[model samples]
Target: MSTPQPQTHQQAAPAPNWQSAPGTSYTSPIPVTRTHLGHALTSEWTKIKSVRSTMWTLGVFLLLVVGIGLLVAAQTNDNDYADVPYTIPAFFGLILGQICLITLGVLVVSSEYGTGMIRTTFTASPQRHRVLTAKLLIFFVVAFVVSALAIGFVGLVTSGMHGGASDNEWGGTVLKGALYVSLLGVLALAVGSMLRHSAGAITAMLGLVLVPAILPAFLMMSESLRTVGDKMMDYNAPNALAKIFEIDSENGGGTSQLVLLIGVTAAAIAGAYVLLERRDV
Candidate 1:
């Protein structure tokens, strides 16, 4: 008061700048990398390979395919295979082995849902379709390759065992069986995605693969339906695989079963995509 107090002023605090780094031009401490389908593929590959179920199921598949194939080959003399292709024995084992593939396929997707990991997956990627595509690609490739190798091994062993009866033409049949089984696995995956429950999807797929074959036997009462039933059995998974092994089915073969399988798988996959898009994780 005595001497006019010096004017006092307080500087305002600097406004926060969250968009940029503190005291620097950098935006963030973490490096940002664009994600693509390849990244998703790698993630799927890691998940499928890392799971215990995958190992167990695939192990059982190999044992069934190779063990039964070798046992059948050993029990039968070379002369016994005179009318049978060297790869026909593989069908017996593969028929059982297909269950393993189906189980694995269902687990591939359904397990995530069951354990609530699917939420994390979607949260991390946000692009659900890409994740599904990656799973499909990696699973199909692995299933196909492993199936092919197992079938080829059985074929080679049986061929050696029945050297005189082995048909060079059997190569195509072996390849066809591998493709068919791989397709079945893919179909199971699609079903799993649609169901989002392990037991439910597995049960549905088991019925899909097996019930058609069994129902035809009970449909013998109706002559009119018998023909249709026969077609169902003939086109069923086991019979189709048998046909590929050069075992004859009532339906004359010109890739009709293959075409049917491809069609069904395509439809299921389309449905899976549509459902995935509309559903919440």
Candidate 2:
């Protein structure tokens, strides 16, 4: 007699493996995050600070600003210059300081190309417009901040030499100077992007800014040529910007000059963007 076999229950059929099943997937429940303009800005900011040129250029700006201010202050016993505000001797250096500022501005773009880092920049930020816009924004912000500090120092130091200017007046002037410097920086960025050559852009910028002043001098002999040159010189765009900082000047009476400067800057930026979009990088 076979002993009664213990009831052997077959184990329940093995559960199917959900992960390896034909129709099943192991998707993560979390959503993927994307980078934003702000991230690009931050990355650019880091790049700017890390570069040696950033420090050297900014230092040159500061030294030229302060050194010229001190020199003018020491030279002038009484403010005789009607071209600039009598209260601040710093305006004497404004023209030279602006040149330095423009060089720094152009380098911000040109340096990257020189180093071959521009390729990396484009790689990290495939969107060209956003990348250019970010560069412009960051450049403007840095220019504004640095110029503000430099102008503030100029005002304070000038105040010690001459009686302090009105708080309202100095505040307005300083704000204007900072923006003025920043606008030039923006202009340089655009030109640099378009030209893609630092030396060329810098030379062109100098020619643009200076030729208008010098051509009028020579053209004074001809009435029509003189008229055009005079208009351009009388335009005195830089002087107009200085007036914004100093509030009063003999040559700083035109309001349209600033509008013209701003318009030119905008056109350059737009032109650069368009060209950058159409051309191969």
**C-alpha lDDT of candidate 1 relative to the true structure:** 0.88
Residue 64 local lDDT, model 2: 79
To one decimal, what is the Cα RMSD in angstroms of model 2 from the true structure? 6.7
TM-score of 2: 0.82
Give residue 199's lDDT in candidate 1 (0 to 100): 96
lDDT of 2 by residue, 49-113 (tens): 88887888888887877788778766765344333444254555566777777887798888888
Q: How many residue pairs clash in each candidate at the backbone level?
A: 0, 1
Give per-model TM-scores: 0.89, 0.82
Best candidate per TM-score, number? 1
* Tens digit per residue, CA lDDT, model 1, 1-281: 59888998999999986775567675578999999999999999999999899999999999999899889888888776777678777889999999999999889999999999999999999999999999889999999898888888988888887787644467776678888999899999999999999999999999999898899988877988888897887788888987788777345442789889999999999999999999888
RMSD of each: 3.8, 6.7
Runs in model 2 deviating more than 4 A are 1-31, 77-87, 164-168, 236-238, 245-254
